[model samples]
Structures are given as structure tokens and as C-alpha cells.
Target: MVEHSGGHVVPFTLVASAAQAGQRTDRFLADAIGTASRSRVKALMQAGSVRRNGTVLRDAADPVRPGQCYSVEFPPAVAARPQGEAIALSILHEDDSLIVLDKPPGLVVHPAPGNQAGTLVNALIGHCGDDLPGIGGERRPGIVHRLDKDTSGLMVVAKTEAALAALSADFAARRIERSYLGLCWGMLTPAAGAIEGAIGRDPRDRKRMAVVARGGKPALTHYRTLEILHGAVSLVACRLATGRTHQIRVHLSHQGHPLLGDPVYLRRVPGPARLLDDATRRAALDFPRQALHAQSLGFTHPATGAFIRFSSEPPADFHALKAQITANSGSA
Candidate 1:
């Protein structure tokens, strides 16, 4: 049977009949649920949303037992279409074909289940109105690339179908230039080098990305140490040769130089923290989000076929954190 309460699909119990015994649990649940697909049931099972006798069940291939009770909990549904909101924007360039803006930290670029409103998509819808082209769907924007919500950076949004097509092609062809500045916990041994790995979802932690040996997309990053502060942290510049979700963070972390204040990757206090004074250590530790900024972006203008580049300095908070570290470092 199905039950709903408080806008959530409450865990509903289902009993497998004798005829349904020995079926794959996912198949059985999918057939019994009626609305959810086998894939959906499998996903829920992987997420531990499906349980048998109150114990979480993760193996979708487990055989169903006759009269065994299973429970499934589905998360709340999100809005299909994001609505426009009058949020502020830091536009750098705007024209009929595209818009370039310095996206601030904490501003989500897309609407997702947890972040349904006040995203860059919502802001763009409000700013451009009907001028925004419907690229893949009415609900999506003409975003050819993306930045993590907490990673402030310059982003280009297409305003027309032609621009969207051209820019998407440019990104796919590796014709775009993107660079970032970040503060990491340790000095790079060589001061400059390249990181190449295949990035994919972490099997151990589904919500995070990792440099995996298999079933991942190849990603490369070139980096140089711009400065080393307190001999404890390094200010680094990175250039992306390929874009993958959390590629920079994952690659750097794999080298044991995880960006400071990266919640997902920086799980423990870096050993270099001991080199800093108490206050400097506190400043680094207190940083609320990843200390990375998209400093520069260059691309061929879709409508004009001219190379266009935009640059932005790190935000005030980023600079302030650096200043605090330097001040405590006793350096000139």
C-alpha cells in the first residue's frame, strides 16, 4: 500500500506473495510500487531508502522472499520548472548572444532538489526574461559549463540558440581557457606540475567525487605555486585542460594538498596547521567554504568569432583570509 504525509512519500510496506518469491528485490518492488520504475527502485535501494523489516537494504539483486515485508521511502519531489527571482548579479559583459558574469560564492548555478530557488538560473530568467534561449529544455538554461555553488568564478551564459550551440561546441573541443586560484594546505614539491587522473563518483561516498582507477573520465590540471604562506599553506594557480565535477578539488586532494576549508575533501586538520600560530590556524580552519576562485576565463565569442577574456580578483573574504595568514606568518 502507498502512504503520504507532510509532502513526503512515507515509507510504505509491501509484502511479497508466494508467486513473487525469488524475484529480484528491485523488480519486485518496482512491480509492486506501480509508479516507480525498476531503475528508480534500484537507485532507492542503493541510497538505503529501501528496507526490509526496518533494516536498510542496498542489494537490488537480493531475492525477494515470500511474504517478506519491504519498505520504501521516496524523497519529496522538486519543482519541474525554476521560476525567475529578482536576485542581484555581477555582470561583466552582456550582449544579444551571451552574458558573462562573476558568480559569487553561495550562488547555485542550477536548480536541484535541495536548491530549488534563488539560483543563477532563476536570476538569469529574471534578468533576461524571454531573451534567454531554451537550449535543452524550458527548465534549463543555456549553460555550457558550471561552477560549484561554493566556488566563486566567472561564468558565461548563452542568450541565443546559435550562441549556445557554438559555445557548447567550443567547450567540447577544448577551445576554452579557464584558470583558478586556490589556497591549499601544503607546498607543492616542484612548485609547478600537472595532475592527470580519471574522475568519477566515489563508491565509498556517493555524494563526493574521487580520482578512480576505472570507470571515470580523464581530467587534467596544470598548477603552479603562486606563494607559500607561513610555510604552512600555498597559494596556487590552476588551469583546467578538462572539466569534470570537482576535478580540481579531487585531483589536488589526491596529491595530499587539499584546498583549505573544502568540506567534502578536507576531512581532517592538515598537518601543516601545526606550523601556523594559533590565530592563523583558527583563520584557516574557520574558513566556511573551499578557498578556490575562478580567476580568469577566455573563449571565442560565439557571435563575433573574436577571442574574449574576462578576469576577476578573489573576493574580499578570500583576500582577508590570506591577509590574516600572512600577518600571523611574521613575513614582510
Candidate 2:
């Protein structure tokens, strides 16, 4: 491996130690690089940026042999405080301490590669003016938690350092309450149950998350079937006891009922039409993204010492799909 110097992110040259040898490329990079996470390494690999002895590495699972030299190129990190964009925000509640947003689909929570501008953070920076810079670091501003780019939901943004610290503690302590609505591919036995699993990067596909029996962080999802769509699909309400990346998706997919329209965790139903009605089938097949939405959020106010709660309904596409599902099911 080539020797270089600097604490900042730059091209990295690393060798596979005996312990790292035979480890997956993504896993090895995550541990050896010290700065990148496994998911970030996977993104680098998927972007065709990681190379082994000058050869581009295509597979995240490519095993690194002992003494193998690999070079990885990472773009210089963007300076904090990306220019603010005047994107409209859906405000649920706002106060001096914090602001709650009913986040809409397609709005990224933060700036990242391929989405360096026009993120929720950018919008907040514009809306909050100078106050945001002091709330969180320059990079994330007020972000306390995040919803996926396509998952519409309620999310709280801190406006002050004190609020940020308090809200962060509440989230870590599991004092924040959150619930989601999702349509899945199949019925869950017992209609209501708790799914306890550990979520980690999928060994087979580092780009996705999975329920690993070991080595993953504990995640629990309590779900109740809200509506049954002809025994083929079910609408469910999910409450998370622990927040993890893609926790609900991984847990549901582990049990063989992946979320409908979820590109990453989809498990197509094997039987006849999961949706009997023609329109419903068409809508389900053409669904744009996962049918999951954060419908409820509750937490104690950091400044007021009062409990606050907020809720949002599914978006238009979600409603359309639900209507089609009901119409197709008839009475069943």
C-alpha cells in the first residue's frame, strides 16, 4: 500500500492484514479506513471508486487476500454550510426550541453525493436564517433524526443547542414515540406481533440492510394488521421500540412479508395476483416507492417541559393505492 499523510479525507491506500484477509471488501474498507462506514464504503464501491491494485472493484463481497493492496478514492468532503435553497417546507409545529416538519417524499434530509443541494437541511437553513448555524454543527444544522428520502413523515428539527442535546437524549433513551403505516406483500400470522431482530448491512448486498442473527444492533417493531387485502397483502401499523436504519423493512422482510413497493427489501408474493382488482394490481405494480409513512410522533418538549405530539396522513399516491386495494378486495 502506498504511504500518505493527512487526517482529512483523501485517497487511501491500505493493505489487508491477516485478520482483514478474506473479509468482504466493503467490511474491510469500513474497518481499515477509520472514517467511512460500511454503507459509505458500499456507496463508494457502487460508484466504481474502489480499486484493487489499480483494478476497479465491482463486487462489494470481493474477498481481500493477505497483503493485497487496495486504493480507494473519496471526494474531498464538502465544506459545511451548503448554500441554502428556498425549498418550501411543510411545517407541523414551530417554536423557539424546535420545529416539526411533515416531511414529504423525495426530499432528502441532508446533503450528500447526487443530492448536494435542495435538501431539507438547505430549506431549513433558508427558513431559519442565522439561528440554524448554532443549533447543530454547520454540516447538519438542525437535524435530530431523519426519514428516508422517499418515506414521508414527521421529523423534529432542533433550533437551539440545548434543544438538540435534549432531543438527542430523548431519542437515544427511547423516550420519543414514533409509529408508521405500511402496506406489505403478505399477511403476518397472528395479525399482531412483535418482531425482534438485529439489523446490519447485508453480507450478500452491502447496499441493503438485513436482519442478522448476530452482530447487528437490536431492533424491535410491534405491528398490528390494519387491513387485510384478500389474504395476499396487508396494511399494518408499526411502532418501533428501537430506531435503526431500515429496521421495519428488514424485520418485515426477514419474516417474508416485505413492504409493498419497497425497492430494496421487496419480496414479491409467489401466488396468484396479490391484488385481485385490475386497477389495484396496476397501481401496486406501478407503485413509485415504498408504501411506508411516519404517521405519528410524540416527545417531551426540551424547553417547555411539556409533552408534544404530531401526526401526518399518507400522501396522495398512498391514498390512491389504498383505495384501489379496497376496491379490488370487494368484501374479502
Candidate 3:
């Protein structure tokens, strides 16, 4: 008998026989499950979906014992390919090899567990039709990079395999130019400097990123303050030296000046909030999402080998937020 666990949508128990004893856990499970491959069983084991008795089993090479009961849980399958949607896109440039666009706030980049439709990928498929070549896989065709759902900015999508390979290589080599505009709480000291840290998932909170001393990838951000509004918020321009998930947000927050309206990092009302008037403070506090935008992107054209760059002003909401904050200072 095996100990009971919860939250498994599809689960089945398999008992090891004397003949199967001493065999590798993953191999035995793969043979018993029949439908799942050895690699798939290993993946499931790694994901903590495989359990022996009551404890989660992760090591695929662990030897099985006779009469031991193993429980395997299978997650629900998702659509093989995302359906195209007729969502509008702000196209900046288009060519045979690539398409550059200004992504607005709240547009997800790819289809995921919670977001299976109405994404930028679906819109691209509709707009490009048969011209959109599958870059990495069927799931996120031609997607070389991504912007967060709430971060508005310029993005480049590869249209062909060659372009995808080249652009991906360029991004990996840090040859691609990327810059962002972020409004953060408080007047950042020195006004211009670089922030360097290694970023990884926060151990305390898996859903958020944090600067960790170990098991983290190196990240760097160079920034200069463009404006200081009412001594409370500062509009800053940031250039990326290395791309990492939430690199700018994590780095800036680690520096004690998280971006304004960042739901994940800005957990409380900043001390600088007192600098603003009542209405301005309320408006700034009520701002919905992070005040960060990918303002510019530059990279060499994969087909033509020509360097091209594109830039966009911050969206109207960003402008309005800044204006509201700066109104007291007569700098709107």
C-alpha cells in the first residue's frame, strides 16, 4: 500500500514485482506505464510527479524495491499549436527574414498554461500567414525573444530559420542593442551608474526573482536618470549588457529603488511617497503595472547584414503617469 497524496489530476499506482526489483526506477516505470517513454518518465520524475510510497522521487537511476508502490501523475495536455487571432499589432518594420513591432502593454508574447490564445504569436501568425516560418518549434513560431505582458516596447521576431539562428546568436553574444525607460520610486543617488548582480528565483518566493549569491546567472544594467519628478520618482534610461529574466527589475529593486508600480518588487508604499501631494500620491500609488518600457532595439539584419535600430516613445499611460507625478514641480 502507498501513502495518499492530493492534487494529481491523473494518477495510477504500480507495484514492483520480485523480477523488477533492483531495476532503475525510470526504466521500470516506462515499461509499466507502456505509453510514456523512458525519457518522459524521467521528466515526470524530475518534475516531482512521480512518488514512491509517500515521498517524491527525483533520481531516475534509483533502484526499485520489490513490493514498493509507485504513484505517477500525468498533467493535462495542451494544444499542439496556438490558434491564430485577428489581434492588431503595431508593426515597426517587416522584411523577408524578420518583423519588428512596438508591443503595447498587456499583450502576452506566447501561449502558456494560463494564456493559450490572444497572444502576440497568434497575431503574428494571422498577420504573416504562411510567411511566418517556424523558428524553434510549433508552440512559439519565429519568437526569438519576449517582453513581459505589462511591459510595452519594441521587439524583433525572426521570420525564417536563418534569421532566427543569427538573431539568437547575436543576442547570446550580447551584440544586440536593447534599452528601456523605467520610472522608479525615489531619487537614485549618483544619478548615473551600473547595477551588477546575479539573478535567480527567490527561494523564499518561487514566483518572484531575487539577487542570489549562488545558483544565479550574471546580469548587468547601465542606467542614467533622465528626470526627477517632485523629488519622489525618477525617470531613468537603462541599457542591458546581459539579458536575463527580470534583469532590470531585479537589479533596480536590489539597489533599494524598485520601479514604481511594480507589483512583484514594489511591495509597499515607498518612503518617497511623502514628497508628492495627496492627489499625485494617490495617482502614483494607483498606477496599475510596472513603469518600464523597452524603448529601443538594434541588431544587424540577418539577410542583408545591415545594422538597423528602432525606437518608440513611451505609451500614453506612461506619459500620463509621469505628468501626474511631475505636475507639482511644473515640469509636465
Candidate 4:
């Protein structure tokens, strides 16, 4: 959702009052007019969006002491040429505290590098308005967890402070369960297994994440083969025991079965497995991104303490890819 136009992101100011006492700068701004997420606020600050008495401010946790005047400005929506397209959203369930959405592939969970506008965050701002709390900062107001840009499926957005706090804690403690469906390069022989590794920045390529021994965080993924694919590929279901950056991708690739269109990890596909009909291969070779989906999300509601689960079918592209593979060789 990153808008590249020479658009103007507007700025606004807030005068501290008694009602806003003890609130952090990020939270106050999120609840203010235009309803931005905490992550958005962080982006604004990172993009030099906030100023305290004409001085640029950076940290979200910076105390909004009483009687201080703060100025915040966002790139105006209009200037970014942002059009509110009526995108259909699949709502699994809803309540005062949270929402579970079946996010589509290519829709980023929240704004980040190369994506700023037209994101789930911006759409939430348009839909939820002032309901989202300031947790992760302006750009990420209600987001408790994230799905990669090309991944599709269920994700939760918090609408209140209590929900935000509770959901955050659940994720931090690994109490919330998330599952995904992925198409990998080849059949996984054992069909059921666990991937345990430490992931960190690739010293050779900073843009990619790799299984590293040093300076990496522990990541665990448990996966089972849901179905065999054309004697070569496999449909796999994965569950996270520890959520780290690209945990599932790293784990699956480490097992020698990179996702079908995963550019970063599985760069070299063996000859026979490249199902593209020469011409189609040339076209698909230029396909923009990878294939991954966030198909399931489950957690205990922070406010109600009820176990909730949501699932979404893979998007059209995912189906199309599978269909192509099926045409190459009958289903397994």
C-alpha cells in the first residue's frame, strides 16, 4: 500500500488534556481523528511524521506528559490518490473486542517497506475509524500478528486496549495458534515432521532470511503432508510453535521443498518439475512474488476467554497453480 505519488500526507496536532493523561503518544494519536493504527504512527515518526513543538519525534513510548502540545501529520489520503475500492472482506466472526478476517493474497496485513496505502491497515482506518487502539504505533493500530504480503488467509485485528494487551500476550506466549497451507517443490517422504532451526539475516544477502547458527532466533514449525501433488509436489499444513520471521518458509526450504513460487529460498528448480509450457514458463518466470497463505487462525478471546478459530480457502492464484500442476500429472 505504499503510495509513490508526490502526494501530501497531512499533519495534525494534539493538545494534552486531563482525559489523555498517562497515555502514550502513539495511543493518543490512534484514537484521534482519522483513526490510525499504532504501526501507522510509527511509520509517520519513522517517515518524520510527528513533531513536538516543532521538533521531530521518533519513539512511540515517549511519554505524552501533561500540558505538552504535540503535532502529527499524515500524508493526506487524497494526495496519495487513494481510492476507497469496495474490497470484499470475509469476516469469520466479530465482537466488540476483535475481528477475524480472511485476508486475500497480495493484500498486506499492514503497511511496510514498499507498501503504505491500500493495505489492510488503511482499509481498517477507513472502516473501523476510531475503534482501533494505538499499540504498534500509527501504521499498525490494531494488528496483533502479521502475514506476509503475498500470503492469504485469517488474521486478527484488535479493537480495544484490553483486547490488544491480551492478544499480544497470547502471541508472545505461543498460546495463539496459527496454521498455513503451502505448495512445495516435491513430495515430503515422511509426510509428517517438525523443522527446528535458528533463523537470522543472511550475511551474503541481507534481503533474504536463512537458517543460521549465530545471531538468529529459535524457530520451530510442525508440518504434515495434507495431500500428495502429482508425484512431485505436496500440499502441506504447518503449525507454528515459535513465530519468527519467515519461519515456515525457512523450515520448508531447509527440508529441500521450497514453496512453488518462492523466489528467495528455492531459487533453482529441477528441470522436469518446471511445469510451465515453455511459453508460459517465460511469462510465469516474471511473476512478481511467492506463493504462501495464512489459512487458519485460532486464539482465546482476551475479553470473553472463549476459544475462537477461523479459516479461509486459498485464493484464486493458489487454486490456479494447483490446477496447473494437476494438469501436468493427475492428483496424487
Candidate 5:
């Protein structure tokens, strides 16, 4: 019988496998777990879970050997609650129960293997000194939701155990409202529409997510065009009915209007000839990362049960990109 030792151990007995004989072990393992992301797979390898013939495989890039039986044990994740740092933060709201923050782009929410320090969690630890009422056995002190490193946005962090539980329940029940602003590659038609697609890890590349027809979680995103920039790009506002991993990025890309500057989803920049003009093309290229910003969040106060909301404007980078595009359109 094939020894796919299940549960915490992601083990596999390889014989008739298509993993390239010279491919990196991490990549091969990512391919093996069709629904797992490569970063996550790499993390598993780093945690000493990957094994080759009962030996711990330390190197992620170690080549796969044909016909070799390999096994992986996924250790239960331990959130290394980061040490407090003096990093500055833009606070929107703070009370005994929760703290709302306007997180800057490039600030990671929590610590993992490669991103060890200088995260928003570190700053929160400093700001909220010793008030963490711990959640879920892991050390992620009050963290409930996450925003990607490059996606600037607003987030709420829980302060006490009771608050954490209440906020978590709210999110799980879909009571929280999230709104985002995004710039995409083309002129998305109909002015407004809803995208209902299932999102899961891409079968071809585990490092990214995609809209898959099968074996994925249901996701819904509603979008309306806020503005059309030069007829080659658009500024869109999105509301999430269901939040799934990389849901907006995957759905928009699946719609053939991948977010501008999205490295993973955009794949290739729009050809210059396809764009409205040179300035618009350059605007697309110069925009550094996926142009996504979490603009607003609304929910009932975990403690008081009163509805409250907070809004934040885009940062300097986002504003400058929009200004340049708007200006260049007139010249063209």
C-alpha cells in the first residue's frame, strides 16, 4: 500500500512520480501538495518536516532523486510572538478591547521564519505593552486578520482574550465589512459587477493562488469602477462578501484584468501597443507592487456592541501613481 502517512505528517512514498529529477526538493513537495503554497511548503521544509528516506532534509533546493521515498512532517505552527520594537505606527482607534491601525505597505503583520523582526506585531507589542490576553495557544498576541506585506491597509488587533474571542466570532460570522481600492490592467466592463469564484492554490505554481473550478473555497467579491485611467487602467473599489486567501487578486486576474503591478498575477505587463499611450504604459510599469489598499473596515464593537467604522486614505505611493496617470492621460 502507498504510505501516505496522513495527519501532521505529510509523508509520501515516491515511485511513479513526475517531480523533475533535478528539481528543488521544496518545489517538488509543493507540486505534491496541489493545494499548498510554495512559501508554506518552504516553511515546512525549514521546520525540519521534510525527510528523504527517513533522513531530515535540511536544504530546500536539494534535488529530488527519482524513485526515492520521501516523507514530510508538518509540525504544528508556533507563532513566535515577536519582541516589542519601537517602530512607529499610525493609530486610528484604541480602546481597552481593540486597537485599529493604518498599516503601511511593506509592514508584515506577524513574524514567520524568514520575516523575523520589524513587523506590525513587534510595534504593537511595544505600544500595547503587556496587555496581550493570548489567543489560540500561539503567541500571535491579538492578531485576528492579516493583510499582505505589500498591501497597505487598515487592521484591528485584539487586546484581551475576551475581545479576541468576540472579534473572531464576528469575522467568522461575516459580520465585518471590508472595502478595498485596487488599480487593474484594463477597462473592466459593465462599470460594476460581482465575481463569484472559488480560490485555491494554483496547480502549476504553489507560490500563488488562482481561481480554480474545483477543490477550492467559495469566494465572492463585488467591484465597481471608481475611475478609468487613460482607458488602459482603472481604479476599482471592492467589497468582500467572503474573504479567502488572495481572493481579490485571484478573481481579478481570472477576469483578465489583473491588478496593475501585481507581480504574481499580472505575469507580463500589457504590451505598449495595447495601452492608451506611453505615459500610461510607464505608469503601469513604475507602479511597484499590486495596487491594493484596504480602505475601510466596519463592525460592531466587540465590547460595547455598537457599530463603528474607520477609513484611511491611500499613502504617498498610491496617490502619486494616480496623479501621474491622470496627468499623462490629458497629454496623450
Candidate 6:
């Protein structure tokens, strides 16, 4: 018989059994629970719900002999209700530790002055409920990183303190890899290259990000041409080594290839790239916002310590733009 001392009751569904136990406590737990922390198992022992032959056991350090049936329960998960709104989300992956969402254009990352609702944070709050980690203040509890208001793509959020710390560290250390898909004007010279510059608020236009001369944080973006549309515009993939604000936008703009429809950077449209037809040129002039989409993300799991990668297809607008490129390719 084992002791039945109980503190926090955690119910677990037993799945399998070994040869009734002749094993070291840590080894047995490791075998029983694939990759669960030993400290968590020790905590279970302290709570005393772990049992052998229907009696509570007290020592996670206790040696075990063969022929004893062992079982344990886990604490109940805290209940929190996630608000479900009409806001659609392109959820790529979700777990206890985090959630990855493919944010679309026209959605801001966080709430701010004059824009409090209809943001990704607000949508996440509605979706994650009270389970979201409350670190980045109450307004943005689980938010770990950000994308600009007009940029869209795969973004991740932490659900727990450990996950938040790990994910933040991964970003800071540049261990997390991100790839973006975008369309920019002109036939890019060199076809593929890297852009390194300092980024700060524009002195001329405070609303836009600029590659400053004296007082901006350093930014770097590496880009490769994916396709050439009508021999004029190039669909590109930009990889971020250091995620500075408006990095890809500023870098590409600095390279003299501002994204199509990017109002702030390419204030005046350059003459159509040789690939544009009259109708396509008209469409380019009326297009709004820089075409940027987060297409890929790779990072390590905070809990399991396993590497995970996710990808998303370019959004509808991106495809439409590509279609226009293909349609007018031979005409140019």
C-alpha cells in the first residue's frame, strides 16, 4: 500500500505499462512520459497522487521493483474562454506554448492611439482567451514580435512565461528564421543581393521609415528573385537576419526598387518597368500598400526543444499581382 497524500489533483489517462516497475524513478518516469521534465515528475511525487497497486506513493526518488502497477494523475488545466469573433485567422499551428497566425494585409499588429480594436492582438485576445501570457502589458499579453500594419504574414505568440522567454531569446539571437515574399518594381540588378543600412524615422516624412545616414539602427535584408513579371517587376523573397522595423521595405526602397503600391517609400511612381502593358501600368498606379507577406518561419519548440518550421502561401493579392505579371509578360 502507498500513501494517499494529495495536494493538487491531476488526472492522467494511463496509456501503457512496463514490466510492473523494476526501474529507477527518473528512468521510469522518462520511459513512461516521453520527454516530460523530471522536475514536473518530482512535483507530482510531492503532491502524492502517484500510486502503485492503487496506493499513493511519496518518493519520485524511490526505487521500484517488478510486478507493481503504477499510475499517476496530473493537475487540471486552468479554464479560460477564448473569445471567438468574426475575425478570420489563417492559423498555421497552435499548441499549449504558442500560436502561429498568418496575418493578412490591412490589419495592424497591436493596438495604438486612434486604433484600439481590429488589431491582431485584439483578435488573438478574442481567440486565445485568458490563456494568453500577460507579459507585454494587458493590451498585448502574448505578443512576442510584430509586423507593420500593412505587411502580412506568419507571426507567432507565446502562451506561457517559459515560451515567451525562449521565443524572445530565439529572436534576439537570430536563431529564429523568417522569410517574406514580396513584389517590387523594376528589374532588379544582380538578381539577388543583400541590403545593409541603418533605419530610422524619416526626417523628411516622419510617417515613413528611412535609411538614415547618422542616427538609425542598423538593418540587414537578403533577397533573391523568385520570378520576373513582364521582364519589369520581380517577385522576391527576403530573409531577415535581424528584424528591424520596416526592414525589407526600407532596404528594397533604398535599393531603388520600392515595392509596388508602397505609397510612403516610392512617393512618385517610377516609369513602368519595360514589362508593363498600358492596362497593367494603370493597375500598378492604383495599387495600395507595399506587397509583403510572411511566407516562412522556423524556430525551436520552447518545451520539447524540437525544431519546428512553418510556411504559408502568398495571399490572394499577391497571386493576383503575379497573374497580371504573367498575363503581360510577352506584351512588354
Per-model TM-score on C-alpha atoms: 0.79, 0.76, 0.77, 0.71, 0.75, 0.72
- How does each model score on lDDT? 0.89, 0.86, 0.90, 0.76, 0.81, 0.78
lDDT score of residue 33 within candidate 4 = 46
Cα lDDT tens digits for candidate 5, 1-332: 12334433345445425546888888887787676677877887778777788788779889888878787665444445567889999999999989899999889888776677798887888887765625433447789899988899899988888888888898988999999999887777778999999988899999999888899999999999999876767899999999898889999999888887787888876643164556656766867888999999998998898999999999888888877777774434
Please give, for residues 1-332, the per-residue lDDT of candidate 2 as tens digits. Answer: 22335755557888787877788899888888887899989988888889898888969998887888888887655656766778999998998999998988889998887888889998998898977876778778888998999999899999999999999999999999999999887789889999998899999999999988788999999999999978767899999999999888889889888877888887554443544666667677668888899999999999989998999999988888877887785322
Worst 10 residues of 2 by lDDT: 1-10
Clashing pairs in 3: none
**How far out, in Å, is residue 35 in model 1?**
6.6
Once fitted onto the true fold, the runs of candidate 1 whose alpha carbons sit more than 4 angstroms away are 1-78, 329-332
Which residue pairs come into collision in candidate 1? none
TM-score for model 6?
0.72
Q: Cα RMSD (Å) per model?
A: 4.4, 7.9, 6.8, 12.1, 9.5, 21.3
1-332 in candidate 6: lDDT tens per residue? 12224554444424234563556664576566775677877777778857767778778778775656667676544224223245677888999989988889899877665566677776877777755636556666788899888888899998888888999999999999999998898867888988899999999989888999989988888889988876668899999988888889899988888898887788776755544777787676667778888999999999999999999997788788778767873444
The better candidate by lDDT, 2 or 4, is 2
lDDT of 3 by residue, 130-228 (tens): 556366778889998889899999999998899999999999999999999999998778899999889999999999999999999999999999998
lDDT of 1 at 147: 94
Cα shift from native, residue 57, model 4 (Å): 30
How many clashes in candidate 3?
A: 0
Worst 10 residues of 6 by lDDT: 76-85
lDDT by residue (83-121, candidate 4, tens digit) is 233456777887888889888777876666567667887
Specify the highest-TM-score model's number: 1
Error of 2 at 332 (Å): 15
